[model samples]
Target: MLARTTDPIVAIATASGRGAVGIVRVSGARLAPLISVICGRSLKPREASYLPFRDAGGEAIDHGLAIHFPAPHSYTGEDVLELQAHGGPVVLQLLLARCLEAAVESDASTGQPRLPGLRVAQPGEFSQRAFLNGKIDLAQAEAIADLIDASTEAAARSAGRSLSGAFSQEIHTLRDALIHLRMLVEATLDFPEEEIDFLQKADAEGQLATLQAQLGAVQQRARQGALLREGIKVVIAGQPNAGKSSLLNALAGAELAIVSPIPGTTRDVVSQTIQIQGVPLHVVDTAGLRESTDLVEQIGVARAWGQIEGADAVLFLHDLTRSAGTDYAQADADILRLLSEKLPAGVPVLDLWSKQDAAPSTGPVTGMSLSAKTGFGIEALRQRLLEVAGWQAVPEGVYLARARHVQALSRVGEHLILAAEHLAARAQSLDLLAEELRLAQNALNEITGEFGADDLLGVIFSRFCIGK
Candidate 1:
């Protein structure tokens, strides 16, 4: 990423499919000769011109509008050309082929290639170019991808905020404060005689405390944003005919899973993603946990255990109609024992009473009582799920963040804590304190992508779609 690529790149900028319009984009240095040759005439810069696109042999392939964007003002900060043509599979392929052919064609007068080293763009190369060319920061470049892959309205809006530099601004603010503190510490280091008095007078401890407070606020918002991006997995576990599938259908508002009165009906795992208050919850309906004679049912039971072991949260359903039975109660207790042993530490398990309408007395239940048939207690269940997922409504809005961001912030907090300890020791650990502060700033830099390992950058950009 440090080295800039001079080679021209071309790609089908529009998504693959038949539509009313498709765009083929090209970016490089001095694309006028290629544009002139392909469009059959020179294009007016920054303006769309209706024209016919021809092959190298001067055969008309299609008619479209072409726009030219000069360097330092375009998406990639390079000379960019966009050809808008009818959006058909063949039409776009032809247009893309023509761009490649025209790039290497020699001019009669100059006897040299019009645009040498022209090739198809790799996935995310366009956005990476924008980042490298100073058109956008690394955080904004990532925001473009996040915005495209967002699954919900809240996630999309948050990504838009990040793309607009909301997240980066906060990181910059933290970095600026750290830099100022580092200046004071480094200056004190130069003159050890005045170090302790200078730090005390300047209220270094107070400044560090204020910075930690700001960081805590940002961490809260960032964790919320990360939750909005990667939602928690919720698994339903219970004996057969406990209305587990029915509850899932009700939550999804669709009959996605087959519901039957017979036991052992669902012999496999069925999953559906449902959104609760703009935060996605991947609700999984696993095969009922039980001791069954059937081979298929045994496999399903095994898989159910597998899902439960890895789940972020588990919904333990009990059949309300069968609650008074001694055998049923004992079986539920046994299953609960196994559930606790299999689950990881800190994984939440919420008990739910199913078939409330079918129960004779409708007596008070120990857990959340709901009737999927009558839609009773569904809203309350949703709120409880939100609580389990750790979602808090941020009225000020959030920026879409990833797991890496949360981890980086945690590291920053750790470094700051170490710095505070060193600072308390006064002159004895001043150098150590300065080093800790420097490391904390680097951690902050990683969040905004000011500096990071190149391999991490590769993994991130490689996930983007081609022509982005």
Candidate 2:
């Protein structure tokens, strides 16, 4: 049930526009009275009744289906009522207005004042209320957002798994192990006068080692999930006419970038979001890298460098036909030098051998024989991309995650590593251990918003759409 002091809230819980039907969702103690006023009769709990919803002027806004879910079992764990009417924007607005007008009558069946009057629901208020009432946790709530914004089918499936608590279960399992270790350590510390050397004990070291290894595995899996959810930005960079655009077109399965034999055809970065095996691949095709006397080409070269520096992954295209196999020594040296100097450190680089169809079957580099026109070696390229992204083919309940979640998990990993180091050093640093534990707990808390109060709740919920 909702807090007795709070009023019922109402909003249309469907996408805006013309549809077959639209739903007006209302929740709180005031729902029943409002329903009665609009329906002109009492509604049985969880029963669908065909009814004419009336406006203040005694006019039918739209005849529709009405259902009521009494408190403690509803979506928001309160008295909930839904009005399904014609999906026309005007009709839906009128139905919503009628509900608002009925808010003035906040009486129970016996005419006793229950809570307060009804108010308009905020964007994510319904889901927020569900979280507050223990219907769903913080991770599942975020998964709802991720599901709504999923860019690829794989991302959507992963998000669905997350909403079903796949990600939460993993986190809980790791947390349980950590909690058990922490408890044992703390229990030993409780009896400081005991002759037992807690840090030096064989059992303590063994447990710590196990916990560290388990934490490491979880961290790796979390990184992969993060990559799947957040995706990678790949930038194509090389000298002019290096077949960069051809590679982009091949990956995108569409002519996303203009293909021209002319150098500097692409004067600005062209970007596209493509889904490869359900993972979003943000590919940026930039103008070929080179010093140019033309002003526009100069600006383009600067932008290309910027893209290369900022990308999560870079593709260095080396046209084998242009290199003629013999002069490739200088080309290879220049390519590696530019890759090291211009691209960001730690960003993955694909040493792409372009025009592979024309290149000799044998080459010094372990280059893939890719024919953008024939779609050869495309699967190999995709696998390579996935490998660089730390993604796996395993379907073990992967979940959608955000940058915030990734950063939080990283902090937890860091603290856990530090804790292991301190314990191994035989340092009686309970204060440091406690501080790290507190930090790790806070990181997990951010994912579920368990530690924050009402103010933070308002900020988090305000980002959702009116429906959910």
Candidate 3:
């Protein structure tokens, strides 16, 4: 998307609906004349005034609270005007149209239009402007979107922390440390004739060690934050009457999926999102995995495998009540064999023995047994899923992060590792070490948008809702 920074932009800031109030926001270099044309009076900077939003015909379009924020103090670092009117779609649209119309109208004495080429703001354009104007970094800008789309309270809290500059501050601290190290390395290169070793005198190795440790800490937190932001997808697969539906309902704490004694009850993927200890788990209850002659049942079994292939984790549920039957045991063995051979590599599989209430002590079972009816072993199952997901308890100062942030941190670690390897070679590898350090710094810089491409910015902001 083309970013027109100079042109004034307007948008309905609040969600579209009939509510108690709605807001039409406008931002530009100088909005006093436009404000006067729209509000029919000069608005004091950073003050709210109850006034009639008028049209060019001198008729009141709507009565609303008008607030003016002068340039360098507003959200986009430009003069801003907000019209808080009655929350009606028609009213907000009318107010927005008036704002645009007033932008092109000339002042009685100045003859020039107050805002030339005023237009509607694009999706995420407001936040993009805030980033470009140095009001917030790229990380904080992303946090704004994350905060809006957060699925769990923990995710929202983490996003809030990132927006408050906690995540960016940590990145800046790491960058500052890297810059200091670079200065010492560059100084040593500049003074080649000096007998004294500058790096050794400054204990550069010690500093690098500390920096690596700090990066590790940041990476750990970023991983957890990413988990909170993008929760794990789990697919449940098992033979008929294995309590897969019951397990899903138990996890969700609601009867989201139908449960009965009949086979093939779930003919499609039944999905639900439930939070466990602030981590969202997207559970998909698939049709029973079995060899069926029925056409629809076969299709469902195929679909079940399809879901399993894309899942982050799979629950290979087994029926403990059917353990004594010879055919049931053989069928369970066959399913286990298929799972071992057909399941995708790297996707963790949890062997769950369901219906513990009926067979309380099934002998020599490999996986955990639980009664979905009685909530027996459900807590252990929840804890195991979290472990399988590599999720730890949300630590203090934890902030929301995205997959890209984790990838960037991983790249930084890779570069640092190469730098340490080069530093080990001492005299011959100082130049290589410095280069590695520079690369590492660049990777970290991308996280905060200190070094990023225009296209990356476009893609990031394009995902945001209009009016940010």
For candidate 1, what is the TM-score? 0.96
TM-score versus the correct structure, for each prediction? 0.96, 0.88, 0.97
lDDT of 3: 0.90
**Candidate 2 local lDDT, residue 204:** 62
- Kindly report which residue stretches of model 3 are placed more than 4 angstroms away from their true locations once superposed: 342-344
Residue 103 CA error for candidate 3 (Å)? Answer: 1.7
Better of 1 and 3 by lDDT: 3
Best by TM-score: 3
Clashing pairs in 1: none
**lDDT tens digits, residue span 1-468, model 1:** 322367899999888999999999999998988988998888888999998999878987889999999999999999999999999989989999999988888976688899998999888888878877888877788889989989999999999998998998998998999988888888889887753677788899999999999999889889999999999999999999999999999999999999999988888999999999889999999898889889999999999999999999999999998888999989999999998899999999999999988884765457799999999989999999999999999946689888898899999999999999999998899899999999999999887678888877777777788888
Score candidate 1 by lDDT.
0.89
Whole-model lDDT, model 2 = 0.77
Order of models, best lDDT first: 3, 1, 2
Q: What tens-digit string does per-residue lDDT give for candidate 3 at 1-468?
A: 548778889999999889999999998887888888888999988889999999879899899899998888989998888999999999999998888888888888799998898999999999988999999999999999999999888999999999999999999999999999999889888887986788889998899999999999999999999999998999998888789999999999999999999999999989999888889999999999888899998999999988988899989888888878899889878877877787778888888888889987674348888889999999999999999888988666689999999999999999998888887787799999999999999999999999999999999999999887
Residue ranges of candidate 2 with Cα displaced over 4 Å: 1-7, 105-117, 194-202, 325-338, 360-366, 425-427, 453-459
State candidate 3's TM-score: 0.97
